[model samples]
Target chain A: MTLQSSPRAFDPSGTEEFAHWLDGVRAWAGTAAPDMSGWRSGAALDLLALPVARGEGGAGAGFLATCRAFETAGEGAVLSGNNVLGGFLFAMSAHLWACQEPLLAFGTDEQRAAYLPDMMAGKVCGAFGATEDGAGSDVMSMRTRAVRTDTEGWCLNGVKTFVTNAPTADLFLVLARTSEHDSYGSLSAFLVPRSSPGLSVGSATEIVGPAGARTAVVRLADVTVGEQACLGGEGAGFAVLMHAMRHERAFILAPAVGLMAGMLRRTVEHARRRSQFGRPIATYDAVRERLVDAALHLAAAQDVLRATAGSADLDELDQARAALTKLHVSREFNALSNRLADVYGGYAMMPDTGIPQLIHDALASRFYSGTDDMQTKIIAEGLGL
Target chain B: MTVDDGVLTVIREAVHKAAPAFDGDDETQLITQQVLDSLAVLKVASRLENQLGVPIRDAELLPRNFASISAMRAFLATKGC
Candidate 1:
């Protein structure tokens, strides 16, 4: 029987193409390639340097290509029990969807040409610095300040916490208050380079999950950038950030289906191999019910994603749908992984099986993009009641 | 027999559960005042949805809809909940 796998959800050609592309990434990384310990310094850049991330593969080859490649990588790594691949994809997705896409949309033509090439080639790593110590959920409350200097350039000062890739990022999309007072239009985004004198990537941050990315405190003490560094300019930060959040919600599920597929396949294989009550445990009604229930959830999550992915603009309704997809899929995948562990009994609990790790990672993902509660709010907003 | 009283009580309880600092004044800005973050807004939505037997659609999720007890009553009244 063809084992139910994550790759099966996509066309065979998509799957095959991604497999080849990812293998090429691995080949490029060579000794620096990802391993059990997690991401290496240069490895992630090489992975991001793929044609899809650069959006150079043409029509179905750029955005779609990146999605297919990551999904395929997630499936293979998950099925073969690679812990770090999912994390790698998580960080990469955040960078591509949240950082690069916004730059393309809001950045001046000059800005795109200057940064996109190096970023796409993985030569200059980048991170979005928005979540401050006090401004996570309430982004408008951010304390970071940017004062336009005499030369029309700006000096930024603030501390952004829990920034993924901050430790290694060469470019930072820093959001700060440009106006003296707090209001909707007070914020602005700036493209600051790591070599800037006053900017510093503070201590490394330790977080939950195997997302193969680095996190740290990004502190800007009078960090200065030229006038051309403004992305959407002053007062545009909030809108830019909102756009990022909406897209983050939509595409963050890029690797989720692959994860669920891995869980289903592993669980089915476990159910078939391990015998209980003188037969394969799959014969048990409770087991069958759990499997059936999981399949339904996975299928439902898939349907939501399929319906929502085509959205061109993440308007209110699209945002709501994206929120639903992220909320439902992540929750279902988390619960399903935990159930699979129960099915494996003692074996699943063992580290070698990777079931327990999957459970932990799922728990980590619960709040990664936005929590279930947050998603509920978004969905309720979409419904208009 | 679920009336405005019931809806208000559920909203109050949910608001307090999410942020005890919250008060149910009709014009209080729950969002701007930080009485409820996105997660708390969701908690309130769930409680309202379950108690009123009325599904809160996404379009009505603006601050004006859940800003206060009076706002919530107006919402439920419009829905005939």
Candidate 2:
């Protein structure tokens, strides 16, 4: 499994276990698993539990396997009608890597025992609340405030936007400013439950890709929670957030690799079957090159994705690596999608063909974890530029 | 000139042990594929540094330094890696 310094067109896949699981997931996504409704099959848990339990070193390898599986499942489903594979898989990754992983890394034993088991068992769905209307890129500029009401209680006020899994999340890891200090360090995170008073989830806002992957605003009008609800301690939220973001940014789109592979395969089939000018489009060197590029991108993305996923540390170096993967893989996926659409021609524009839907969905990949622009910032910092 | 097979083997082994998914040749784009991703990069870098007793840090973190095995070999040769 030695990584290549350079590559040519070739088939790429995961370990036997990952490939086997991916096959099952693809079948599930095209059939039962893509259900928009809560299907307590514990599929998400079953898919992810192994890697996450393995910790960072083991988690890296394990997560790469899981992501490879998710890529195929997401592609199979996204190619067909039930792309809830988009929302479900993305939300699952966010919950596991962003919210749960951080908690597992920094949380108390009581905290882990109280929240994690239920989540692992598929008894609960989780959401991460960080982005705000005024604070997308500049997260530290958020207006959300948390005031210490007592040693064991705190009141939080403000709104969180674009919260994934919010429509069904039983719990939220909310970030809020806890001091007059405007520095990012003043920010803190709270583990707020659905039952907490003054905590309200706005109506689910439909987004570009799939219906199941809903986003909404969470407003806390002086919401109060016990000290036990705090993830890590006060002023530790930024560190916690960075840790979570490092994981999320790197692996958020690992499944898109599968999506690209499926698209390329389908496009090739279409090019051969749907001929023009008395010949198949596949005969054209230009069209062939496009397919080859798609294959090349898929291989390249998997390599980087595996590298980021398999890293041992979660420091600045890991952060840069994850940012690079998120940035490169997303842009590459978008390119592959556009190429796929062009290769399909006018029929690609037709809604029934699902190419248009895929195009729209592919565009949304740019914003999932963070935008490519944000990733560039991290990469630039790493270069000391 | 091509990089010596021994250097290539060590780099490949370091990366392979760290991540089992990558199987690119010397001409493969390592950065694009992320075969030398952050975590694996440290492992490979440390392995090289230990093998040669030279620190690879600071200005040496450039992507071009690790874009491919050939690039890495050339870069390492500059530092007598």
Candidate 3:
């Protein structure tokens, strides 16, 4: 379904369309198994394929629609297993640039056509291969290298760590060093199809949050891709990633805000219903204050997130705002989750309480799409400090 | 007069404004470290852009631009400061 008018970016104070889209996503998610693991390969594919089906004008959804869907999914009991997370990450990474005017800012037209349709359709899932074992925040230090081939294509070499869904991904947006010119010109992003030779996903590693979501080391042992695989330009990977990351952070953080919203609601509901000292904990001054503080933070985060996401759509400021949004929301979200656990008290420590799970899930937000420190550094540099 | 003077003055003002939030001379010495750590530079960048009446381009937000008051002045010069 085509959008009525491009969904108008991501407005927290927007109309009922946001609520309606969220309700539909919740209904859809409700139909699935509570365990996100079951949806990993199949249902996850369908969700990723959504944008493709909706078409570039948008699937009658904008950043707000995507955010609402993420919120619905966040509230559900599903583990944010690799497949689930990877699908959304890939979809957002691709759509962030391709869907906008002057198509294919990062990837070439051929790359966009081949990947975007399938990526948007979810027929093929992609992983953002950025964080190497040696590099997390320092993009300039990435060792993953891509050297051009004489016949055609490029050879990729290096390993990526914390790759959310490499095991199941159909392709990867691999950021590798293409030139030794300088730190800025050193890195580039490539659309490396998994079917390419010499590309393999190593053993799945267990992470603290999002069980059943596979995190694995991706080993590129001279993986080769046609010239078409080059995204944007050879040395332009740094630019591409900078552009893509803005939207990626915005989209990812939107869901994160939703997660905070979900956690806050649960915390409040528990406080209101549960009792302590002969009255509901909600009646206690300290608990009430904490809850109120959490609410305010949630509101403020949403405001920042909406403003940052909107600014991205309107202007090209190298995605500094998105980084700012990520840093703020993720940091605040961690605090919010801690408050939630404090409200839950001992129950939060129990494995089955789900509060423990939520807390664990909250911790992962700090690492992905660049750490909070990294976000701060980007914001600092962006701010011209 | 070189634009460096104005840029340095703005940096000084931002540091001073953000100083109250920080404590001690040691911490104050590390203020540059903290402010430049993440996107905090955006706060400083906005301050300079507004104060200097110059649009800060993305490339101009690099360390060289903020490494020193002198560096910031040099960066602004490229923007027709």
Candidate 4:
């Protein structure tokens, strides 16, 4: 049984259009099959293309609608035991935040015309190459260099780690230093194709959770591209990344919301079915309290996510709101997972029970986008402290 | 184009509030000079948006726009503030 909270309940806008779009996503996600081949399933592609403009081959849904879709997809993944589809949703959402959103916001007309159609169709996959071993939160410390060529364009050489979708990505939005100086203006973003002569993707890194996501190290050695490849101009990498992070952090926890809801659903069902001491375990104060607490945390997280996604639509979502949303939602999700584990008893440790997967994915949520510490710093600074 | 002294005053107040330790003139590079980090830049944008009643778009959050008080004024003028 699903939670009492309908998909429409999380939608703060309350428009019929958004409600209808969410319904469509729920129906599609319910029946969509998992594809472990690293390519996006057709049904998944349809959902991924929802937020793009109709002219760009999408359903013309807005940001809030897209986030709700991700949340629904997460719930569906839990019900169906399809972590592959869940991983695809996560990776594709990264594509939207890092590649699609940036292109829509800052890419030139030719760049959009060249990339958007195939990207929307899932004919090409894009990965974000920003994080490095040396520079995770310290982005300005990135050692990737893009030196100018004697002819035209520039040559890039660097290593980007933790690149999601790197194994199957046809394109990568690589951020590199254009100037030797270690400053914000020194960096630039480049859209390098996987077919580039000096570009290679390393074997996928085995992450603890999000089992199907193909993250790996991407290496570029003197990879050259034209001036047209420069996104948001020569010195705008910082701005591009900031813009992406604001939206990314705001919406990244959507799947966790769904996962928590799903975990609650399963735990409640198990409690009702599993009997102890001549009664159902759900009747006991200990089990019931855990269930109630999980529900409360889920409700609070849903509200925060809705508010943050709405702010993004209004273009008023700042770093503080985004960080707070990430911080609150992820912490609640992790906590809920632990409580549910207690309710599941020994079954929680078994692979078949699904509690272990839920716990792992929930833990992984706190680290992605930014750690809790990073979010706190952003919120504190946003307060003008 | 000339910038109004009033606009400059608002910019100065917002920057100072965002970065209480910042001590610079209108020509001082707030971004390049490292007086304001990325989060501080957002705080400045938010404060300016409230004081000037003009919304700052994400695309407009470039370092060049917040490089200095003068650059901010020039940006505001473009926004028809």
Whole-model lDDT for model 4 versus the true structure? 0.79
Q: What's the ranking of the predictions by TM-score, best on top?
A: 4, 2, 3, 1
Local error of candidate 1 at B47, Å? 25
Stretches of candidate 1 exceeding 4 Å from the true structure: A1-32, A35-65, A313-317, B1-81
Those runs of model 2 whose alpha carbons end farther than 4 Å from true positions after fitting are A1-18, A33-39, A42-45, A54-61, A78-81, A312-317, B1-81
* Candidate 3 residue lDDT tens string, A284-349: 888888888888888888888766655544444445577777778877877777777888788888
User: Would you list the rank order by DockQ, best first?
Assistant: 4, 3, 1, 2
In the range A202-225, model 4's lDDT, one tens digit per residue, is 998998776556799999998999
Between prediction 3 and prediction 4, the one with superior lDDT is 4
DockQ score of the complex predicted as candidate 1: 0.04
Candidate 2, overall lDDT? 0.70
Ten-residue stretch with the least lDDT total in model 1 chain B? B56-65
lDDT of 2 by residue, A153-175 (tens): 99999999999878788889998
lDDT of 4 at A247: 74
What are the TM values for chain B, all candidates? 0.79, 0.81, 0.62, 0.91
Question: Which candidate model has the greater DockQ, 1 or 4?
Answer: 4
C-alpha local distance difference test of each model: 0.67, 0.70, 0.60, 0.79
Q: State the number of backbone clashes in model 1.
A: 15
At residue B79, give the lDDT of candidate 2. Answer: 76
Backbone clashes in model 2, listed as residue pairs: A4-B24, A5-B28, A6-B27, A6-B28, A6-B29, A7-B28, A71-A255, A304-B33, A304-B34
Candidates 1 and 4: which is better by TM-score? Answer: 4
After superposing candidate 4, which stretches have Cα over 4 Å from the reference?
A1-39, A42-45, A55-57, B1-4, B17-23
In Å, residue A245's CA in model 2 sits off its true spot by 0.7
